[model samples]
Target: MNPRVIGTVRSHLVSRDQCPKYGDTSMPPVWIELAPDFEPAATDLQVGDAILVLTWMHKGDQAVLRCHPQGNRKLPMRGIFSTRSPDRPTPIGLHAVRILGREGLRLKVHPLEVIDGTPVIDIKPDNATLQGTAEFSSLVNPDTGQAILSAARDGWLRGLFAGFNGNVSMRQGERVVITATGSAKGHLGPRDLAVVDLATGTPLTSVRASSELAVHLEVYRNQPLARAIVHTHPPKLLALSLRGEGPLLDLPLFEGRVFADKLTRVPAHRPGTPELGQAVGVASRDFEAVFMDNHGLVCRGETMTQALGLSEELESLAGIAMRR
Candidate 1:
């Protein structure tokens, strides 16, 4: 069978380093330029979607490999594959990054950790294991029994909602309730928010219950580690969705850090319905944020702080893209 090569990636050289210390060293942000033929596949990638990034080890110094893999100045070395050392026989590195969004031939990805101008050899979808880990479990909020609420309420959430013009809410156990009083952009005061229990699919009594209450309920129900959920209508994100843009191009922005592991993008669905909730649940199975095409954005964090931060970052990114 022929090995399929789907996309070609190109990044410029920035610097050279050894072992785990490679990502730690300073280097310019390498812009990843994908081949034009890959645009269709590239645009189709969504938040939380994982891709295998292959890069030519241009800066690889063979002599460096003979030294300690850790380059600790004391410890002896092992084979390259044994220690994830960049100095390998093939002089190639494979990194897994989350797709943040795209601009023309450039893709913004998260967790790149590679130096700027690194030559990218190829790009492929990452289809690996589907299992939870203690890493995610550690983010859960023990006091509130919510995973991401604390992080969401912290500066992260505030940043996400900064200048946000939409309704916001919080979920208590099985009940979804309104927590914020805000008007939609260009709309009048006191917009109503509604929430519905996922188990019963019944509306709860709250003046500002979230319209997409089911979506939140689904996250809480599906992901044991999830605690807080956020929904908003950032103009650029909504505009891209309306334009039939499937997912924002991946960029290595700060928001990517908070949401690196669990970002997902859901196709647009009618707002305030069980279908919307189910769609969100599916998209968020392995992601933190899900882009709802033609509608808005939905994100679940182990803490509200994390969720909030991601929300704000998403909006800011959208704004940045719009300005560009």
Candidate 2:
């Protein structure tokens, strides 16, 4: 069966080898050249939005069912289904990219690692996962929303979030105001925050809670000291994880070596998965700061401001330690 191509990827990358295993901040902006027939679909998309781009990797080997992960021969061979290997019976490429700009029939997105000329099957808004939305309230808290908006602005200013990539949650008694899923972290307001019950991870606000809500709830249940949580994509900290120095950042700098705690590096897990959330929740029980391998950072604090500060401090320490 032939799937109609709705769009095409126009990226600088020519092959899978040139792209990172996981697309991140380092990737160049890529354009989705939609066919004029499909231009109407562009009306719903906007700049600063995160959309899931489904594509057909025309260059992959569909006949090869199993291989080493990421072309590394040393790693044991595994079925293609277990890994995100593009080579499979159906070589569909999935990318969660942030919209940078929109034109009549074109959209510029970031962190899309597919090669140029790849066929795009479809695009859809990734506002929030429906896995846990049934328990949330549709109403929002004006006060909590305002505070998180301020914090999200600070995160954007510090380059901790690439678009609406990161999330923040502030606990108020038994409830927490979490940044709503898929909302722009830089422009968050009360409307963009979800009030949730810490015990059940159920949202009391109308907007759905962030995809990482499970981990946030786990922190509250496991760590009494964790009154607030800040999850951000600090480039330096992410880089450290990529280089294998994140688990023990024993840098030469006095402050870097002595002040920071040993970061807990959680193994790579599919983001937003229950397993991933459980791993983070378990890790946060012992470590105040956790680094998600190949992904981002999770920091807890006694207050919202303190949690925000931990994100900045973690980035600073990562920068200093790596420089030494």
Candidate 3:
């Protein structure tokens, strides 16, 4: 069987040596100029859509079957298929990228490390239909999944961060429904959420849980009354934090007086680490809201709505304090 090229990559990197071994969120945008005939195949794609881009790595060596990982000569060589090395018998390159925009048949995407003029093979939406190893538990009901999506989008609309920088979760007995790791919170879909067992921190769904799952689990374990958690980086709050303002109790609003009783500040700890999770968990025993130094905020409540409301209230108060 022969595969035909449908497009050519337009990138500043002219050689494979100039490309990153793996692309990250900060990489510059590159254009995929598809053939005019393929316009119909890409018409449905829109900005912010997650997609998989298939390309032919023309510079790869088909005869090389094994190589050291990441060019680390100190490490042992492994089969090319076992690693992400571009060189292989087929030399097919797969990249998970977000559609930055589209002008006619030229689609702009981010974090793609392919060289200039590479042959584009196919494009597919990175949606929930992709299967995984997770065996979902019975606790992830429809309502729970929808609630998590709603909260994630709400937090995203609230301008918490520029991208998928926060996480939201709701407890269901021994398991919790959480936003998937690296998922664009503002554009979350059914596949962007995960169900994980709280006791063992193991996923019960096809997707992996947020990296901050440890922090959520700790809060649930420490606060029996807490049923939901919302973690976000409010711009105003982060600004205040940079100005050495660690507490939000200075506001003159009525909600400030109420939240102050349940508000506390925790020293900054590296995110997604056990230390951060422990510090937030200890603070959760008394404070419904936690101000993490140099980080953001973590709010817990008896319901998802309450937790989200508390986060909104605190952010509003921060905005007020900033103006004052």
Candidate 4:
């Protein structure tokens, strides 16, 4: 049975050739105007909600059964079904997205790699990965993504991160933008940061973002006041966290109150899991900076500069603790 066209993409592209390959993370979010017939199906959906989008790759050459992956001529040809190539017997485009905004039947979603005039086969709520959706990576706008990279490099130079460890993020509307996983933090560039829907974790881009993304998302959801976050595995902080009430807390001074007042320690929870995210969220509700037992620390602020400064100041305190 053929799928009914429930929606159409409204875009500025004048031709299919103008579209990028599927899952192009760099593409910006666009609008999907659903038909009046499918409007009732959108019940319970709201802004920031994650959805599974099914689109008919109308521009694809369905007759071609085999092709190189991503249209790369250097790769060996494979069956169309074996790769994500949009050209296939039934070019159904599958995408995980979050609702950015909605007005009547028109809705906006990010990085949906299809071109204008494409037929949308269906749209379903992304329930399975919804809880983990924020972990999915999306693209940060070029200018902003690049600016965050400079801070990331500074984080490395200042020893907030070592090797490929640590993560950084800034929230923008319905999504959270973060550093990519496994990329060298010491020498990061603009393309290093990715975006994911804040509520659903739907990756807005094709890049693989850091797994610790949940930590960032949880903080954003719990504290709308927080716009930026910095996470680091400082050796001194980790060492002190292992011992309850370390010198960082016992120091009798005004600096101690500024640094340790309302500080929270998340009970040991495995990193990169929803449980750990919940733990951080709970701790963050009352504290600007938190120490994860036997793990690391998370610092948040209204801006990246504040978060970065807090991270740096805490390091100094942790160093003092280590010396005592």
Candidate 5:
């Protein structure tokens, strides 16, 4: 069945300048009313599940395109296609948002660069294949299937982490392998990492990578579609999680329903234990970003890019909430 457009995107900040310049803005909360027959997949969502986010470019002034070829603030002129401007010939924007969570029809999404109140055109599942060069590893005893390890070794794992500007690592059996370099490493440490056989709970490898790994592993086990995960301790998300507050309801500056049914909150877990992993797994059942009480935030997707996008979205929402 074709996916349906269940929500309208509206902008909290109506001014053109306030709109997102890049396709990475933290979208204000917008409401999404699900179709009567629609249902989210079971097994919860992982860090990297592909989602086709349909958004209405409410602030897009299609008429303005005739004046400038490109919406380059710095350049004198370029065509709309030449630059990533929202004022396109067609004012429709489709973003792939990682599922944060769902509450009835409300879905909490991440990394939607559209302006607030933009009407959502539709949402579909993105089943794109992973690239050949993506780095991957096997996980022993994946909760779902026996070939989970083979899937990883064969690179069947989706490219969930693509285009992420962060440090990430992987674990196979007893080894911890760093996947990226530089700033990614600065945010993670060896002491914060750990690995274990999914079925047996036997220790395989452990390192101080990031306390957030607990959440990542949980989503991997619980969410069938999740192939990659990202955890970021950005100040905005951290502050919001630290507040130990309730779910984001009203969009004071922007619509809140855009993220309807997609956000979730997970109380902090005991560091470095199967319990923590189980908590993350449970929380990830349907949401992307699971606000870790007093710790940080965790986001899952079918790919790394989606996961990172959700992380950035959570941070943006946190920032918006803080300002309020």
Candidate 6:
């Protein structure tokens, strides 16, 4: 029996030679345009969900039974079943991707290396094997983790973090859910985050914790009321710091003063070091936000919303300060 084609991939890749051996985060965005009759099947899918997309590689060489791995001529020839060659008898392509967005019948996904116009045979939720690299802890709240992800995306879209220069975390009792090192804040997937012990900073999952985990742990140690933290390199703040601005809280407007009364200034120390963490942590005890010399800003709040809001407020205030 023949499988029905429910959708077709819209990608920049036009041929097998243009595709990478394996899909990765560096690949461009791809759209799976489902037929009108098949749109109902995708109603349960949401942005940020991990999914497995099965595509029929129409351009593949179905006659080939064996080939070199990844088309490398030097590698020993392997049977089609033993390799991920697109020239298999079935020529079915399985891609593990994250849903970036959904617009009507078109779903935009990332890291899909399939050729343009490839027929999509099926779509399903990613299993544990797909996300095995990062083991999520049962003790950590999923809702809180999603919130942290939202905050990270917001910060990236707001130009708070340049590249992957910042990290976000939330305290949940004795554990902290945090973004993994080098994770793209705006395009985070399930495996891009991890949970760690709050006191010892030991990661609970196989995924490694952020390099600045020390700072988050120290802040939690000093501020018992803080449940969330946001660290970002806001452009305006960084520029002002470079100009030798004395205090980030010294704003011209009265509302700015009131909005940031608890903002404090911390001396510069090597980032990701215990000294820097200690300095920020001590300052966060009395202040809601800290401006580090030659560094960036760190803010804490009762929730991630509050923490992100405080960081945004400081960035806006910094922009105002720069205009003067």
Per-residue CA lDDT of model 3 for 1-114, tens digit only, reads 337999999998998778888886677899999998888787656555567899999888889999999888999999998999988889999997767777889889887999
- Identify the leading candidate in terms of lDDT: 6
Tell me how many residue pairs clash in candidate 6: 0
How many pairs collide in each candidate, listed in order?
44, 5, 0, 5, 64, 0
Runs in model 3 deviating more than 4 A are 1-139
- The TM-score that candidate 1 achieves is 0.42
| TM-score (C-alpha, index-matched) for candidate 4 | 0.58
lDDT, candidate 1, at 83: 68
Candidate 6 local distance difference test against the native: 0.84
Provide the lowest-lDDT 10-residue window in model 4.
Answer: 130-139
Q: Tell me how far the alpha carbon of residue 261 in candidate 3 is from the true structure, in angstroms, after superposition.
A: 2.2
Query: How good is model 6 by TM-score?
Result: 0.59
**Among all windows of ten consecutive residues in candidate 3, which has the lowest summed lDDT?**
129-138
Candidate 1 RMSD to the correct structure:
18.4
In the range 1-324, model 5's lDDT, one tens digit per residue, is 223455654335556676566655446544344555545532233333346776656566676554343344565676566666677667667675655545665566666655555666566655331222231212211221222222222221233222222234333322223222222332222222334444443443322234444445666667776665655445665655556576653355443455524667666666556676678788788787676566555666665556666666555666677777
Candidate order by decreasing lDDT: 6, 3, 4, 2, 1, 5
- Kindly list the per-residue Cα lDDT of model 1 for residues 159-229, writing each as its tens digit: 43344334444454444444324433222222233334546756533344445556777777777666667
On TM-score, the stronger of 3 and 6 is: 6
After superposition, candidate 1 runs with Cα above 4 Å error = 1-165, 179-198, 201-208, 242-246, 252-262
Q: Each candidate's lDDT (Cα)?
A: 0.56, 0.77, 0.82, 0.78, 0.50, 0.84
Tens digit of per-residue lDDT, candidate 6, span 184-216: 899876677787877788776777778888889
Taking every candidate in turn, the Cα RMSD to the unseen true structure, in Å, is: 18.4, 19.3, 16.2, 9.2, 19.4, 12.7
Q: What local lDDT does model 1 show for residue 76? A: 76
